[model samples]
Target: MASNGSDPHGPDRPVVGLTTYGERAAYGVWDHDTVLLPSTYPDIVFAAGGIPVLLPPRPQAAAAVDRIDALVLSGGPDIDPQRYGADRHPLTGAARAERDAAEIAMLQRALEREIPVLGVCRGLQMLNVALGGTLVQHLPDAVGHNGHNPTPGKFATTMVDLVPGGRVATAVGTTVAVQCHHHQALDRLADGLVVTARAGDGTVEAVELDERPFVVGVQWHPEQDATDIRLMAALLAATRT
Candidate 1:
């Protein structure tokens, strides 16, 4: 539903707007149209005590921000190649230019209003690009890792080390293993953003905006990983403030 420039619920529940994937027509409808986010997303949000709202790609994003308290850019296909000034890799997936614009608008609004945000996987990349950051188009090919982004249908476990006293370490309370499935990663950490975690091989794994109340992003899929519960908890805490 499009917004009419008003807070729909008047600051009660902390509403988190998550970006959705785009789909091209397949037969009558695109397969991505019906693509569902892992149930873990809402489960984890609710577990962390926040309301989850899907943020569809819309041109009227300024109006949408009025109704949300926070934002969570969910994982999906690769971000648009033009965003970071690169050619599309053969493996890049569907790019929703509308979704990219909407999410960035949401991110900007959240920051201006000081709303907490938690970006996961593709969401993380979105946050980086939105903040003038660049991305490594293909991690394994560029950085020599097995597969930073695993096949979309399956899950893989990998280790992520956190810099001592970094946001992710302070939140997770440990430099431990996590589940990763991205083939791309942050090549240049956004200005004012700090690298909080990384793969043992030096692939950037997580980043957080120091000035924002709770703008944290992780390359790994935290919603699917048991070790990253602190990210949700930290974001929820920011909503209360």
Candidate 2:
């Protein structure tokens, strides 16, 4: 899909569509209301030089995926285990069906249109499940540790070693200290994607398309710190070409 002629981004700057989580959120005096995403996401995109647009849980948006230059699958609630033909683990959290439907559709359409994509945290799991892969529902049972999301609502620093000559290595470096908070991970890789990085515990940390422009997914939250900016910047760079 060619760039929208009436769009403001024009040819100089590409508009990056970042998927947002829709849930009851509270702020200031407002008790609760539906919100798009955590401000950190769009902030990082802006700092990376892309015009960030918050894509809420509207299934219609998925059909226009080709109109954007790139797509950022944001982190959120656990994907339904049924998505990958598995029963839910006892520790699996509540699933977000609306978000699941919208994001999966957008991911598929974005891939079909060759749009650059960056999947973070739960986003990584979504990418895998969308491509007919399964997830380690209760990671601690398989990885033997909860370091991925040590705290319920806090970030943990994890040392991730990148696969040599992979896209992640080319974007960040051979190894990186990442900010992460998740309790699940990939168990089986998809057909067209390859593992690009891993944690010390052998958890799959990152993956990239074998032949695409800049489709990549990381189990960590890169938007949480400055050190991971290069990864986001790499996605922005891919939009121009």
Question: Which whole-number lDDT from 0 to 100 does residue 230 have in model 1?
Answer: 74
The 10-residue segment with the lowest total lDDT in model 2: 1-10
Query: What would the TM-scores of all predictions be?
Result: 0.85, 0.93
Residues 19-129 of candidate 1: C-alpha lDDT, one tens digit per residue: 665554355543435434567887777666567877667757546777877788888777898987888888777787887887788888878877778889888898899
Give the alpha carbon lDDT tens digit for every residue of 133-240 in model 2.
899998899878888888888999999999888877998898888888988899988888899899999999999888998899999998887545788888877765
Highest TM-score among the candidates is held by which one? 2
User: Considering only N, C-alpha and C atoms within 3 Å, which residue pairs clash in candidate 2?
Assistant: none
Please give the lDDT score at residue 67 for candidate 1.
82
CA-lDDT, candidates in order: 0.75, 0.85
Worst 10 residues of 1 by lDDT: 1-10
Model 2 TM-score relative to the real fold: 0.93
